[model samples]
Target: MLEVVAVCDAILHSPWLLPVLVVLIAIDGPFPVLPSETLLMSAASVAFGTHNALAVTGLFVAALIGSVAGDFLVFGLGRSSHRVLARATECEGGLSSWVRRHLLLRPGTVLVGARFVPGGRLVSTAAAGRFGLDVPRFLVGSVASSAAWSVYMLLIGLLLGPITGGSPLLSLLAGAVMAVLTAGLFALVQRVRAYRARRALAAAQHPTEPPLVLVAPR
Candidate 1:
């Protein structure tokens, strides 16, 4: 246990930590298995250990830059896929129609809304490229999304660090709980929005049938 704790401490204080964070977050956009949020929160927990404002700021900057870069990278990949294939492939447009209807309809909501959704960021960014969405518009949305995500992750770590007294294990457990709750909340919100959208679409398409009337006696 002592050795394990020692290794964790060394990693938290290591000079390579911040750079590693940037790389992880950058790759996470294309490959989500990396657990970018978990890493960011852990870094925030470490920052809280020092009670230093600069630590939080450093993390925010690194995460933001990494996330934005990754967004553009995936966008490029999508664009290349479309160009090479001469059509929108499944990977590029798999969820795009749904995104356009339920999520991407509004410029401001695209990035911010998708950030909370699972696999949403990947699909949205890729779709932008696949559909040839304007570069400047996509970049603006990406920036907003990445910044919000970084801030939220950092706040989770900072809050849990103090609560758990900087114990890595405890902080991790608490962070996991919070992450789950946040995901569930977002999912619920999405489901409700989707349901409403479906209903509205149905109503618009079908309209209401006129009531039947019988006048045989007359």
Candidate 2:
């Protein structure tokens, strides 16, 4: 493990590493399962320890570009495949409905927030395209989301890296753990919010009936 960490630390400082990192992050949008976040954080950690401003900046730019690029790619897919995809999937309507009702109202907030949720970024971007959200508005939200997400993961890695005395592996592991915990917390909150919304909706639809007067029975 220590040997692996040492090798990673060495590579993180390589001149060609930044560009590769950028590509990985950029394409990760279409592939949410990619370890884009992991790479970003890991690179940030190395940069932090070495005080490499160039590497740090490069990682940030790469991540931001990758995120936005990937989002737009998915957005385009949604536009072209909306009908077919919707017809093919059982949950399409529900997903689209949720995005339209919650995400479209304030596209910027939801876009940034969605990046924190597992599989949410892809869903939100695709929904935005499929549901006819304004392109300019969606792009604006995309920029914000990309910036916030890139900064967040990078910063977490940067903080954790130094604590481990510049151990890339340890920093990456710590950042991953934090990311998982954060995602879980966000999911729990969303569930609670959804439950509350459902309950409120149900109450509004069915008010309690008043009791009939007993004297009328005579």
- lDDT for 154 (candidate 1): 85
Worst 10 residues of 1 by lDDT: 85-94
lDDT of 1 by residue, 45-127 (tens): 86786687898898999998999999888888887874532233243322455656544356547767777687777877776
Model 1 residue 77 CA deviation (Å) reads 1.0
Model 1, 19: alpha-carbon shift in Å? 0.7
- Give the alpha carbon lDDT tens digit for every residue of 64-141 in model 2: 887888889888878887664444222633344566677668888778877777767877888777777799999999
Q: Which sections of candidate 1 miss by over 4 Å?
A: 1-10, 82-95, 101-108, 195-218
Model 1: colliding residue pairs: none
User: RMSD of model 2, in Å?
Assistant: 4.0
Each model's C-alpha lDDT?
0.74, 0.74
TM-score of 2: 0.77
Per-residue error at 5 for model 1, in Å? 9.9
